[model samples]
Target: MPRVFLSFRKVDSRWMRDRVYQGLIGRFGAGEVFKSGESIPAGADFAEILRRQAAECELMLVLIGPAWLEARGDDGMRLIDRADDWVRVEIETALKAGNRVVPVLLGDATMLPEASALPHEIAHLARLQFLRVPETHLAEELERLCAAVADLMPDIGHGSASPTAPAAPAAEPTVTMTAQVSGGGSAYQAAGDQTIRLA
Candidate 1:
């Protein structure tokens, strides 16, 4: 399965983030998608975890909101100040690791400024490929995003056949067991005796 790193301004798009996370989980299964608040453990070293996730991810999806350009960190520092800031670090590491960096424009955000106009650490983001989400069809737009993610990881269950089939007298229940490790360090395994793991 290919890992994906999700980068966004938390305060600016919390609802959108949750929706995107749920959509990705529905398409790619839970383990392959990583978000800062949900994928990283509470007390873990954030910078290190972000770096590790970025290095392992096959793609990085940046959710750009209206305020994203002016977002600031908890310490009142601009997000572009340090390379270790979540968005900056993830994009930088993804680029260095040779992974695809996709900038998704959510809402009615304008084009990103030129690299020379951006802060040093995040200037490279200006050159990445960008996709814009339509204002009305949020779910449909998310589906498109999921499709893009699926394109990168064809085997990770984005379009895999469901284990269950319509009820038929001669058909047996084809149950599949999948294990998922949550960001909080919880292991979730399918609850069934005759479960076959998906390849």
Candidate 2:
């Protein structure tokens, strides 16, 4: 079964995030999905906890809005430029761990900027395929998303790698030959796609 990770700048897309989380939890079950504030307990080392949890998830849904890239740090620079930005860190961890990442464009958000415009750790976001799920048709989009995830994480119900069958084993062929002497009877044999000519 695949564990779900929801990544986003909360302030930039709170409504969309909340709705998406609800839809996913409904489809994937409560304990199967993960969100920062919703799932994380109040404790020391909260940042470290998020980092570790994000890395362990099997699939990640990144909700992006227009302001996600525009968000600025207290220093007035883009948050993405900061090494410790939680969103950036979360994305980088998922990428390095080979988790399936789905970029969800919310509201009017468009394609992400090129690698040169993003932090080195998360530049790969530019290349990841993104889906645009309109706010009005969230349910319909989620239905489609559910179908896709079903194929992507077929182990959900079975608690295994996937629901597909294992490949069949193959066998090697064996060969035998019989030759006739002067007074002995002749024998004949035929093999698939193989022809023998006699002089």
Cα lDDT tens digits for candidate 2, 1-199 = 2387889896787877787778776666767777877777777577877788788988888888888888997789999888888999999999999988888888754566678989988888889888776777778977776666678788553443324467887754555444444556575576864455543
Candidate 1 local lDDT, residue 88: 71
lDDT of 1 by residue, 1-199 (tens): 3377888877666677688889887776667778888777788998888888888887788888777777776888777666656677777778788887888887755566568867676677889878776567898998987877677667666334323345766756767666555567764465454574533
What TM value does model 2 have? 0.73
Which model scores highest in TM-score? 2
Which pairs clash in the backbone of model 1? none
Off by over 4 Å in 2: 157-199
Q: What C-alpha lDDT values do all the predictions have?
A: 0.74, 0.77
TM-score of every prediction relative to native:
0.71, 0.73
What clash pairs does model 2 have? none
